[model samples]
Target: MRAEAQAYADKINAALALLRRFIDWDKALRRLDELNARVEDPTLWDKPREAQE
Candidate 1:
C-alpha cells in the first residue's frame, strides 16, 4: 500500500536525520579533543595568538 510505503519512507528519513546529527556530534567531539590536546602542549602558550584560536 502507498500508506505503508510512506510510513517506511518517513522512518528512513528520521533515521537518516538522526544519523546526520550523530555524525555532527562525533565531529564536534573530535574537534574538542584536538583542541584539548593542543591546550595540553607546553608550546601552545608560546604561540599566544594561535592558542587564542
Candidate 2:
C-alpha cells in the first residue's frame, strides 16, 4: 500500500514538472510572437540592435 502511494506521488510530481516546462515554453512563444510583430514595423530598423534581438 505504501509503495502504491509512493508511485502515485511520483507520477503527480512528474506531471507537475512537465506542466511547469510547458508554461515556460508557452511564455517563450508569446515573447517570440511579440518580437515578430515588432519586426513587421517599418521603423524597427531605427533600433537595429533591438530588432536583431
Candidate 3:
C-alpha cells in the first residue's frame, strides 16, 4: 500500500510539472512565432530531424 501511494504521488507531481509547462500555450506559441520570423532568409535549421522522430 505504501509503494502504491508513493507511485501515485510521483505521477501527480509529474503531471503537475507538465501542466505548468503548457498552462500558457498561446503565449509560448506566440514567442516561437516571433523567433521564427526573425530568423535569417535561409531560415533556422529547417530540418528538425531529431524532433521529427
Candidate 4:
C-alpha cells in the first residue's frame, strides 16, 4: 500500500512539473494585466484587430 501511494505521488509530481513547463504564469499574468489595461482605454475599440485579439 505504501509503495502504491508513493508511485501515485511520483506520478502527480511529474505531471505538475510538466504543467509548470507548459504554462508560463509570469508571462500569462503580464498579458492579462495588459489586456485589463487595454480594456480601460477609450481607443481600444478604435483598432478592431487589436480588440478582437
Number of backbone collisions per candidate: 0, 0, 0, 0
lDDT (10s digit) by residue, model 2, range 1-53: 99999999999999988888768877878999998899789999998897777
Return the lDDT, model 3, position 46: 72
Tens-digit lDDT string for candidate 3 (10-43): 9999997898787887787798897666564363
What TM-score does each of the candidates earn? 0.52, 0.44, 0.43, 0.51
Candidate 4: regions farther than 4 A off: 1-21
> Which tens-of-lDDT digit does each residue in 1-53 have in candidate 1?
99999999999999988988768877878999999899889899898898899
Give lDDT: candidate 3, residue 21: 88
Deviation of model 2 at 41, angstroms? 0.6
The stretch of ten residues in a row with the least summed lDDT in candidate 1 is 20-29
lDDT of each: 0.90, 0.89, 0.75, 0.93
Candidate 2 Cα outliers beyond 4 Å, as residue runs: 1-23, 49-53
How much is the lDDT of residue 38 in candidate 2?
93
RMSD of each: 8.7, 8.4, 9.1, 5.1
What lDDT is reached at residue 7 by model 4? 100
Index of the highest-lDDT prediction:
4
Worst 10 contiguous positions by lDDT, candidate 2: 20-29
